[model samples]
Target: MERRNCVVTFLRVLLLVLMASVETTALYGVKLKKKEHRNAYATMMYMGTPRDYEFYVATRVLIKSLVKLQVDADLVVIASLDVPLRWVRALEEEDGAKVVRVENINNPYKGQRYFNKRFKLTLNKLYAWSLVDYERVVMLDADNLFLQKTDELFQCGQFCAVFINPCIFHTGLFVLQPSREVFKDMIHSLETGRENPDGADQGFMGVYFPDLLDQPMFHPPVNGSNLDGQYRLPMGYQMDASYYYLRLRWRVPCGPNSVITFPGALWLKPWYWWSWPVLPLGIQWHETRRQTLGYAAEMPIVIIQSIIFLGIIVMTHVARPGISKLCYRSSDKTTSLIHTALKFIAIWSILAAYLVPFAIIPRTIHPLLGWALYFLGSVALLSIAINSFLLPAIQVFVPLIGVFGSLLVMAYPWYPNGVVRALVVFGYAFCYAPIAWSSVVKVLARLHVSLEREQFLKLVESSAPSGFNKLF
Candidate 1:
């Protein structure tokens, strides 16, 4: 009994010592981390796809500009598996900067084929930031070009995040203090869809840090005009023609020989001007001269295509006046068209609406439009089957043409050939065997012949003939 008691006492003492040592080590680690964080300053950017070349250029320019302003910052650019490490390194080297390559994490929604590349890249950055000793970190999108100094971002400390006004938070530009807890929360939120179920990191952050550190976060005033009641930063900060002209004026007479021009109103952008005389010179030019020329070169092609699309609509209207009457007569078509046209008109009326107004607007609006177009296309396609028995082929095709044409109009600006390509593929499949089968079924059903019964009887009676047969 004494020996057992002695052993128990020794074990207790050993356990206490282990606990004490662990506590001391943890304390030392905390102190070291705090010290490292104080001196660390980091910035991160993501390039998920090479298609984001504009963003890439903007990021490069922003980082180079930041360095030029003498900011002691480390800019880390993250790329996916699709992006070659050598290319990324070359880009970093060109700016005399360094980039770290991170492997893409598997996302269930994105799958192994790489759907949500941006989301994966961002999560990787957050994970990396957690490992590093960073006091403050700024995350900027590759599209964001910094014309002025962004050193003020590093000054933000302790708070979960510091950024531009919530209304104008581009998500492209934000600063945060790194923490393991924050990284874990981000991953959890992404997996569970609890924080930002809609999948926006900015939205998640906004909700996560509402009462951060028991103090309301600071949202800086927009430097530009606020007449339109739209949240927009100054022109030089995030230059886009539509927003600039709307808040300011069309022919903004600012400094000497410096006039900010909104060359593209609704359907056109500044780059669309083929004539050199019409093109604005000096500061009014787009950030990249090549972009301006590319826009100009591409505009004529778009305009020509629009004319062709319009001609198709007109031909359909003339060829099948009955379908036109149905569309114009229906409450839904009239309402939808009027509503869409009015909204477009209202947006176009804003002086700067064509330029960068979209930049300030909630990102949800674009996706909403896309969804609306998809819904309308679906409904119109469904209508074709319902009206097959009631209307002629030409009439049915008329409404389909109109519905698809509208979707094409709305999407062409952003997704150039997406709608057109889909339409062509669909047309090819429709013209093949499926359409013939549908026609045969429709005709048989109209003639009071049950198609299924008729097909089965025909198969069984392959050797038999109709009319009177020799019988007993």
Candidate 2:
């Protein structure tokens, strides 16, 4: 009983922490002030080819956001040896950035060159510590956006970063003091293979600053008294955009933060116009580029995404039934195919029109279209499951409860304002909950049957004696 209670307590704590992390609100309220140190906001980029122009654009937008907010800091670009001289000149002269050329480090993990280039491009970022010109530097990834002024981060100590996991900090945005000694120590760690346990600079830095959380925080003299936990930077300093998908209720996209970092692959980047079709924040990124950088080329992306989106819709209508029938084995293939196709279209029509719009376009831009599509799509999606008889009635009822529950709140006769309108718009996502579950159940049922058959044949083969098996 004691052990069970301890386990429950641990689970509760873990659950609470995860829930807090998902909330797009500020966790800590520690006051911050800019220090007298030479503060710099730095980012790294390597232009291996013309395709690498995306990084250049990302760096420009980052600088523009910083400048727009009037953040008291110098912008530094840690460019690679491969970066074009013209780009370097542009960053320095045109963008008012200080460009520092650094060498690219080879991927420590074999066959991870793609992952390293896209995700863990932080090996060269270590060179920021060698920039003794800046007394203190806040290194941000080129993919980050400034929500507000963050010059006060300079007041923090040598090591300051947000928690990525339970014990490790994300290397996307971090504060550091530049010194040859610290740089050499990191180099030594790299040379000795003692730098990264997880084979990335993220883990490497965590190992380098093992006692970061336990360290005594820097307290400003103006505070008049020693205040505890002044060094701990709030999680709001670097908000992850992925949290948007977790809690559909807390709909403030930017949330309360000084910066929002989109930490993902090339396709997942917000600056990429092709990414606009998928990522909701891509619109804001594109707007920033258009207004600040005078970059407004989006026709190519619109054409491509339209083609892909329409292609998927066409495929869903014409080919989905045929594909779904392949999941099961039947002697009468024609009858099975016909039945599958009929049932699929029936259920798909129940929800496709409703949900597909939400999947395709962001709710902020077209709420009316999204709502219309939501109801239509729900009808299409339901027909596929209902005709197939894969989902239980409870699955349908739960989502209805969600829809009506929100509707009851929204239908309050006295109030009808922006908040209410926003609620009505966003709350429509819950209406498709039953369809999502039904789709999951349908897929799992087919998979279970396939798995069971395979297991049964294996059991039959094993149950027979060795001699009998050999005779057969």
Report, for every candidate in turn, its global Cα lDDT versus the true structure. 0.41, 0.58
Report the Cα lDDT for candidate 2. 0.58
Residue 326 CA error for candidate 2 (Å)? 31
- Tens-place lDDT per residue, model 1, 1-472, is 9999999999999999999875543222122212312433333455555435434443455455555545556655544445655657655666655554444443434443323445544544453345345566666544333444545445444443323443323344445666666666656665775544324445555565555423422223346543344322222133433223123211111122112233233223232222111222212333433322223423454445445435644554343323322422333333445645533432232213123223322221123332343333333333333222122344333434444444444333333444454575466545544554565455434322211334423332442233212220
| Candidate 2 lDDT tens digits, 35-118 | 233778888887554447667778888888887787777788878888889888887777877877666665464343334444
| TM-score of predicted structure 2 | 0.54
Model 1 CA deviation exceeding 4 Å by range? 1-54, 105-128, 159-169, 212-472
Residue 186's lDDT in candidate 2: 74
